[model samples]
Target: MAVSLTASGAAPQPDDAATELRARVERFVRTRVIPQESVLDAGGPAAGAALRELRSLARTEGLWALPLPAELGGGGLPFSVYAQLAEAEGASDHGPAALGSATLLDVTMLARHAGTRVRERYLEPLVSGEIRTCYAMTEADVPGTDPLLTGTRGGYAADGGWRITGRKWFTSGAGAADLVTVLARTSGAPGDREGLSLLLVPTDSPGFRIVRELPVLGAAGQYEIELDDVRVPGDHLIGEAGRALAVAGERLALGRTLRCLRWLGQAQRAFDLMCARAATRSGSRGALADHQLVQQHVFDALLALRTTRPLVHEAVALIAAGQDARTEVGLAKVAAARMLQQVTDSAIQVHGAAGLGPDTPLPALFRGGRAARILDGPDELHITTVARRILRDYGPQAVTPG
Candidate 1:
C-alpha cells in the first residue's frame, strides 16, 4: 500500500489494508497476549514455553514481523505503515516479542554492516526468530549515551582474531541472546571518537559471561555482562574499523522512533483504563466520572496522547524516507516519554490503591514510562541536542531581544 504526503508534509492516513492489519494486531494482543502476561512475567521455563506458543500462533495468523523485508520472512511494511501497528502491539509490554517483531533494530544494523560470512551465519536466523541477539555498548562505569567514553578494547590476536575485554550493564535480553553486537575501541584512546568499532561476539565464546540480571523498576530481563578476553574471528568486524559511531547512529534514530510509537500505545492503554475506572467506580459524589476533578484528569490525559502521536508519526515518516530525522526524533522521544509517564500516573491516581497492585497493568506501564525517559538517550541529552540544532538556524545574533 502506498502512503501519500499531505499538504503540510505530514504522513498520509492509513489505507484499508493497514487499518485491517492494525485491527488484527490489536485483537491478537488483547485476546492472546494480555491473557499470558502473568505467565510471561513469572520468568521460568513455562513462561518461555508460553511465549513460544504465542509466537507460533502469531505467525500462523500472518501477524509476525511486520517491519522486516518479505524476502527475510516478514510482512515487508514500510516504517510509516508499521508505526500504527507498532502502537497497537505496544499496548501490552510483551506484544512486540510475542508477535516476533522486536528484532528490527538488530536486523537493520546487521543487514547494512555485516559481511557475507557474518550475514550468512546470523541474519536469517535472527529474522526468522530462530535465534535472538543483543546490542551491548553501555559500560558499568561510563554513561552509555556518551560513546566517546567507551572503555571496552579489542586488540589484535596472534591467531588473526581479536581479543575483546569489557563490562556492560543494562544489556537487554542478553540472558537469552545467542549473539551480541559489541562496541569496542580498536585504535583510539579513551575519549576519542575515531577509534571505536563494532564486533559480533557469540555468547558461547570463551570469555563471555553473564555476571547478573539487572532489573529495571523491579522487572527482570536486562543483564550485566563481562567479556574477559573473548576472541572472535577477524571477519566478525562490522563495517570499517573505527566507524562504530556512524553505524550506531543509524540504529539509534530508528530505535528511538520505534520506542516513541510504543510509548504512545502504552499511554493510550493507560488512558483507557483511567476513563473506565472513572466511569465505573463510586466516589463521595456518585460516580467518579461525574466529578469535575475526574473530568480534568481525563481531559489532560487525552490532550497529551493526541499532541504526541503526530510528532511520532512525523519522525517515522522521515525515517522511512531515509531523510535526516534527528531533530524530529528528539522532539518525539521526549514528548512521548513524558506523555506516557503523565498519563499512566493519572491512571494510577484514578484507580487508587488497585493501580499499584498486581491485578492491573498500570504498575508495569508506569515503570516503563519512567524508564523511557532515561533509555535510548535521556531527556537531557535530546533536549540539549535539539536546542543547539535549532539555534544554528537563526545564527548567534538573530535573537537579540525578540
Candidate 2:
C-alpha cells in the first residue's frame, strides 16, 4: 500500500502505506525482537551479535531508520507518521536501536547547530549506525532537570581549544558511545542560565573518563562521566557559546515526545499480556477474567492505555508542525509515564509470581515504566512547569481570593 503524502508534507491521516509499515514493525517486534529478550538482556558479545544481525535484517527488509530522511539512508517519513509507527516498534525496548532509527534526536540537533567540520565528521557515521552518541548535561551535584544548577565548566585553553572539567552522571549509553555532547558553564556562575555551552567531546579524548555505570532500576546503561581538563577544538562548540540551554531544549522536546510514544507502546504490550492471562488463568470461582476484581484491573489498564495515547500524539503533532508544545509535551510526558507505570504494575499483579520472573517481559517493562517518570525530567518538574505556564495566562484576577 502506497502511503499518500498530504499537501503539507505530513501524514495527517493514516493511509495504506502507514498501515503496512506499522504492521511490518509489529511483526518484527513480535516475531524477531521479543523472542530474543533473554539473550539481549544477558549483555555480551553474543547479545551484540544478535542486535547486529537484527539490524542487518531490518536493513534488508527496508524497515531501517524510518524516522530519518532518505538522503541519510532512512525511509524519509515525517515525525507524525513516525510517531504512529514508533508505537509498533516500542513493543520491544530495543526495537528502535535494532532497526537503526534511534539517532533521530541527536541527528536533528546536529543538523540544526553542529559546525560544518563537526557535521562532516559525525553526522553520516551517526545516521548510518557506525557510531553511537550520548548526551551529558546532568551532574553529580546538580539536578539535570534544572539546567540553571549545571556545574561543569569549559574554559579557554592556551592551545585555542576548550578545556572542560566536571563530572556528569546519568549520561545514558555513555559506556558505549563514540561521542558525547557535554553541557558546561563557559561564563557566569552556577545557577545562572546564560553561561552554559554544549561541547562535543570524543570518548577517547585525553582526560575524558567513564567514572562508572549508574544503573537505573537495576539496569546498566546509564553512566557517570568525568572530564578533567578534556580539550577539544574551538569548532566543537554546538551553536553559539553559552547557549546550551536553547540547543538542549530543542533536543529534549523531541526526545520527550519519542519517549512518551515508546511508553505507550510498552503499556499496550502489558495490557495485552494482562488480558491474555486473565482469559486463561483459572481460580476457584472460574477464569480470572470472570472475577470482578480482575475485570476491574483489565478495565483500568485499558483505560490508561487508551487515554494517554492521544495526549502523546497531540504533542507529536505540535512538534511535527514546528510549533511550541511545551505545555502539551509536559502533559503527555507526565500522563504517559504514570500510565505505563500503573498499567504495568496492574499487569504484574494479574500475573502473580510469573510477572516478577523472567518468564514474561513484565519485570523489564515495570522497571522501564518506573524510570520513565524520573528520566527526561521527573513528573514533579513537568507538573510545575506546565502549571506555572498555564497560570500565567490567568493574571492577577485568577490568583486573587474571592
Candidate 3:
C-alpha cells in the first residue's frame, strides 16, 4: 500500500491492509516480547540472549524490518503506521523497541542518510539482527551539554584512514554493540558547520576503549567510552565531513517524533500496570484501586497519557508530511519526557513495595521512565530550544522562518 503523509501528522485514512499488517505485527510483538519481561528486567547476558531470540522471532514474523525501507527488506509502512507499531513495540519490555534496544530515533536518521553500501553493510545486519549498533555522542567534556562544545576529535591518518581521539561516555547500548556511530570534531578552529562529521567506526578497532559501564540509578548504561588514537579506514566516516551537526539536527527532528511516541507507550504501560496492581492490592477496608490516593495517581497517569498521545500523533503527522515541527518536537519532548517520569513514579507509588523490588518489573520500568529524559535529545536542551524560539520571537504573530 502506498502510504501518504503530510506535516500535520495525520494518519492517512487507514485501509484494511494497513490495519491487518499492524495487527499481525502487534500480535507477534505481544506473544514474542511480553513473556520475556523477567529476562529484560535483569539486564545482562540473559537479557541479551532473550533479545537475540526475540529478534529472530520478530524477523521470522516479518516484524523485524518494520522501520526500514523495502529496498533494505523493511515493511515500508508510512511513518504514521510505523509510529503506531512503535507504540505497540514500545509497550513491550523485551522486543526491538524496548528501552535497551536501538531506539527508533537514532536508526531512522541513519537510514535516511547512510549510503546504499553502508545500508547493505551495516543497516542490513542491524535490521536482520545479525549485529547491533550503538550511538555515542554525549561526553564528559560537554557533560550533558552541547555537542558544539564536544571534545571528541577525528582526523585523517597517513593511509587515508581516520584516527579518532577524546573521551566520551553515557553511550547507550555501547557495551553490546558490534559498531558505534560516533560524532566528533574534525576541525578545532573552523567556525563554520563544515567542521563536524559522522563516522561509522567498528567497536573493536585498536586504541578504542570502554572505561566502564555507567550505572543509571542501578541499571547498567552499557558503556563509558574513552577513545585515544582509535583509527579506522578513512571510509569509516558515515557521511561527508562538516555535516555532523546537520545530521544530528535532522536526526533529532525524527528522533523526537519517535521519542514522543515511545513516551506515550511508556505512560500507558505504567497506567495499565498501576490499574491492575491497584485493583488487586488490599488496603484498610478494600482494594487500593478504590482508595482516594491510589485513584488519584491512577487518574493522573491516565490523564498524562491521554494528554500526550494525540499531540504525539499530531506532531508525527506534521513530521511525516515534511512540515517543520521543530517547535512541536521540542514541546513534545519536554512534555512527554516529564509526563512519563511522573506516570512511572506514580505507578511505583501505587504498587507499593512491589514497585521497588526487582522481583517486579516496576523498578526496571521506572528506570526506563528516567531514561526517556536522555533519549532523542535531553529534555533540558529541548526546553531551551522552546525558550529560545519563544524569546527570539515573542509575539502573537508566529515567528516567521527566516
Candidate 4:
C-alpha cells in the first residue's frame, strides 16, 4: 500500500522488520484476537475461554510481552513499531481482547519498577502469562489528581516489610488479578513527590481486599479496592521509596501512547463503518455518499485521522532513538484523543441515530472513543505538562509548538 505522509511530520514509515512484525500482529488480531472480543463482552465462562485462547495464541505467535526490552526476551521494537501493531489491534473491537485479568499497561509498569528478583519471580510469569498483574493507582477520595490530599498511606513494618493502608478505585483488571501493584505515600510530606512508594502486593494476601467492580461507560468495568494495612516483604517494594510516582509517571506515558494507538484502530474501524453505511444509505441526493454534507463529514474524519497518525509516528521515532519525548508524546495523546472523539462523533452523526443503537457497532465504538479523553492523564494535564516544558526551556518565548 502506498501511504502518504499524514501531517507536517515524517510519514509512518516502518523498517522491514517493523513491517513484518505489523503483518504478523495484524494476522493475529484478525484470526485470533478479534474472536476474543465477543467472548469477553459476554462475560463469565465465555470471557475465561477467550482469555485462555488469546494467551495461548499470543504465546504461540511470539507476540507476548511486546513492550519489554529485547534482553528480557521481548520483541524490543521501537515504540513507533509497537504503535503500528497496537493501532491494528485496536482497529477491531476485539483488540484481540483479553481473557485473563490485568491490562498490558500494568504489566509494563512492573518491568519499569520491580527489582531484579521481583522481576524474576513475578515479572517472568507475568510476561509468560502464567500470572496476571493490575495497577491499583486511582484512589477513592482525596485530591488524588494533585497528590496533596492522597488518602493512601504506607509505612515500613517491623518485620522489614511494608504496610499500606488506603482505599483505591477505578483499578482496571483488578477483579481477577494475581499480582496487584499499587502506589502510596510512604515517607514524604504532603505534596512532596519524594514520599511516594510503589508496592507490589499479592491479591490473595491478608488485608488486600477487592471491594467491588464498578461499571464504566463500556462493557468492561473497573474495580474498587480497599488496602487495609496490606503487608508485604520489604522486597515487594518497587524501586526506592519515593521514586515510584516519578517512575510511574514516565511509565504511564507509554501506557497512554499504547491506548492512543488503540483509539486510532477503533477510529479507523468506525470510519470504515461510516463509509460502508454512506455508500448504501439513501439520501436526498441519492446515496449518502453523494450528499455534500455527508461527504464533508467523511472527508473531515479521514483528514483528522491522517494528520494525527503522523504525530504518533514522530513521537515513535523520537522514542525509538532513545530521545526524551515528554512533549511530543503528550501532544500526540491530546491530538489522538481529540481526533478520534471527533471522528467517532461524526460517524454517529452521519449514521443518523442508528449509530446510537446496540444493533450496530458504532454505539460501542463511540463509548470506547470516550476513554481516549482521560485514559492517559487527560488532555488538559498533558497539555499543561507540554506547556510548562516549552516555557521552562524558551524563557518568555514559551509558545507551544503545536
Cα TM-score per model: 0.97, 0.95, 0.88, 0.89
Off by over 4 Å in 2: 1-12, 397-402
- lDDT score at residue 295, model 3, on the 0-100 scale: 83
Q: Which candidate should be chosen as best, given TM-score against the real structure?
A: 1
lDDT of 2 by residue, 363-400 (tens): 99999999998989999999999999998878876766
Q: Please report, in order, the local distance difference test score of every candidate based on alpha carbons.
A: 0.91, 0.88, 0.73, 0.74
Model 2: how far is 384 from its true place, Å? 0.8
Candidate 3 segments exceeding 4 Å error: 1-14, 43-45, 97-107, 115-117, 190-194, 395-402
lDDT of 4 by residue, 2-98 (tens): 2233456564666677678778777777677655566677678878777777867776777765655666555555555566677876776555344
lDDT by residue (tens digit), candidate 1, 35-127 = 999999879899999999999999999999888878888888888888879999989889999887899998898888989999888887887
Ranking by lDDT: 1, 2, 4, 3
Winner by lDDT: 1
Candidate number that wins on TM-score, 1 or 2: 1
Candidate 3's residue-wise lDDT over 146-219, tens digit each? 67776778899899988889877878778777888888888865344568778877888887778898887877
For model 2, state the Cα shift of residue 239 in Å: 1.3
Collision pairs in model 1: none
Candidate 1 vs. true structure, TM-score: 0.97
